[model samples]
Target chain A: MAGELALVADILSIISLIIGIFFLSLGMIGLLRLPDVYNRLHATTKVGTLGAFGVLLSIILQEGATPMGIKALTVALFILLTSPISGHMIARAAYRMGVKCCEGTCMDEYAGKRRK
Target chain B: MKRRLITYMALPVVWCLVSGYVTIGSLFLGLIFGMIVVEPFSKLYRLDEVVHPTGDWLAKIPKKIKYFYVLIKEIIKANIVVAKIVLSPTINIKPGIIAVPIRAKTNIGITGIANTITLTPGTLTVDISDDQSILYVHSIDATNPQGIRDSIRDDLEKYVLEAFE
Candidate 1:
């Protein structure tokens, strides 16, 4: 029974690893291809964060509820906590710098609003 | 009063995680260390008023759990949508910033909503207005501004309000 459980875990870990790498690569493609910083942030903050999280999740699954697994889980939690904040900071900086949106862009309700 | 106790309890929990030691001896040591340092830390930081829960926090646990589940589901959906956008043949995405008027009163609720918007689908929260009445969201697909506003209001902000406010 233990062997079977380990096999199931291995299978799930492999699947998770594949999905992680796929999302990571897609995020890279997005970073390269997207027009502006705001659009690119949509790629990195969401896809990239989830990709890293999935990879860490696979590590925990493979390692079980050991010390290493606990550490991996902590790292994942930190990533989730910090990734969006960093992305928000970058987007705010870009907007403040007057980085205009791509040609396909249409609206900006924050155009003339106070920056406070 | 209650806030200080919770912070004292949290110190040991954080210590256990960081040290990667969940043994009884480790936890006992952690508790001792927490008890010793918590008072000085609180005094230095003036955290008495800061750690207090905004409302009926204990009663919101079930709602908070539900919100967490929803957030996870939205994250997966976001990834799938982003993957499709990136993989498509023609890169035709209308990206722009739109002001999303918020109804969340608490600071924590507003921050939670902004963070949730950034983590979900194609939206990234650029900034909040001075009065905290508006959030500037950069959405990859801004063809229909009302659509984005409605979706966030109905799906995301309501959950944040329930959980945090």
Candidate 2:
């Protein structure tokens, strides 16, 4: 039974790793092709963060509930919390610096607004 | 008193979990360090102000769990949508910023909503209004700004209000 469980875990780990790498590569392509900082952030913050999270999850699954698994999970949780904040900071800075949105942009509700 | 005690206990467990050393001696050492850190700095750690002291904590746990479930599902859906957008040939996207008026009153609630919006499908929270009443959101698909605003107001904020607020 334990042997079968280990085989299942190994198969799951490979699948997770493939998914993680696929997203990570997509994020890289997005960062290169996206028109502006805000759009790039959409690529990195969501796609990149989830990719890293998937890789970490695979590690945990492969290692079971050991200390390494616990640490991987902790890092995954921290990545989820911190990645968006970094994206928010970059987007806010770019906006305040008067960086223009791309050509496809349809509207700007906070166009003339400045933080008080 | 209760807050201090909770902090004191939590800090050591955090220390052990972070350091990956779950032995007794390390825990005792962590306890000593927790006291040293939390004692003189008790005034700075005003968690009650940050997190409202809501009653019936037990009742909120189920709601919080459901919120997490929904969040994870949305994130997976978002990844697939973004992948499709990125993989498509022409890159037809209507991106822009829209001001979303928010109902979450507390800092935690507002932050939670913003982060949740950022993580989910094509929307990203850019900034908050000076009065804290609105969140400026950037959407990859801005052709229907009201759709984004209504979805945020209806779907996301409902779970946020229940869990965090």
Candidate 3:
């Protein structure tokens, strides 16, 4: 029974790791193919963070409920808090620098509301 | 006074978590050092004005934990949507920055909402008005701008109101 459980854990770990790697690669593809800085930021931040979290989950599955697993969970928590902030900051900076959105961008709500 | 005492006591607890040692000697040393660390910041900690008083803040922890759980669910949903958008062969997206009028009263409440919006689905809090009445958000998809604002007001802001206001 113990051996069977260990085998289950290993299978789950591999599946999760593959899922993570898949998302990370998709993020990279978006990064290269996207039109402008803002879209790139979206792709990298949102998809990339999820990908990283997937990898962390795989670590937990592999390690079970031990201290290292707990630490993996903590690291995931910190990533959730910080990744969006980084994305927000970068997008804001790009806007402030007067970077233009791509042609496909359907709306620009802050179009006329700039003081600077 | 009470605020000062609470921070002084709390710092050592935070220190223990960070240092990852629970020995009695380490805790006692943390207490002494925590006092020294927090003393200079005593005047700066307007805990009564800027935040809930210490006891009230402590009382809100369970509600905060519940909020964290809700936030995680939103994040996972968001990531899946983003993954689909990014991975699709066609370069599909509609991006805009809209002004999201906010209702949170205090600085802590406003910041809490802002951080929550930035972290969760399709939205990012870019700037706030001088009077703090509105938050300017750049969302990856705001084709239905009102939907974005309503979701933030209802889902995110309500719990923030519960915790901070």
Q: Largest lDDT belongs to which candidate?
A: 1
Model 3 chain A — which ten-residue stretch has the worst lDDT?
A107-116
Give the lowest summed-lDDT range of ten residues in model 1 chain A. A107-116
Total clashes for model 1: 0
CAPRI grade, predicted model 1: high
Which ranking of candidates, highest lDDT first?
1, 2, 3
Candidate 2 chain B has its poorest 10 consecutive residues by lDDT at B46-55
lDDT of 1 by residue, A1-116 (tens): 99999999999999999889989999999999888888889899999888998798899999988888888888888888899999999999888888888898888888989465
Instruction: State chain A's TM-score for model 2.
Output: 0.96
Q: Could you tell me the lDDT of residue A44 within candidate 3? A: 80
**Poorest 10 consecutive residues by lDDT, candidate 3 chain B:** B46-55
Sorted by TM-score, highest first, which candidate order results? 2, 1, 3
Q: Residue B2 deviation, candidate 1, in Å?
A: 6.3
Q: Residue A18 error for model 3, in Å?
A: 3.1
Each candidate's fnat, listed in order, reads 0.85, 0.67, 0.53
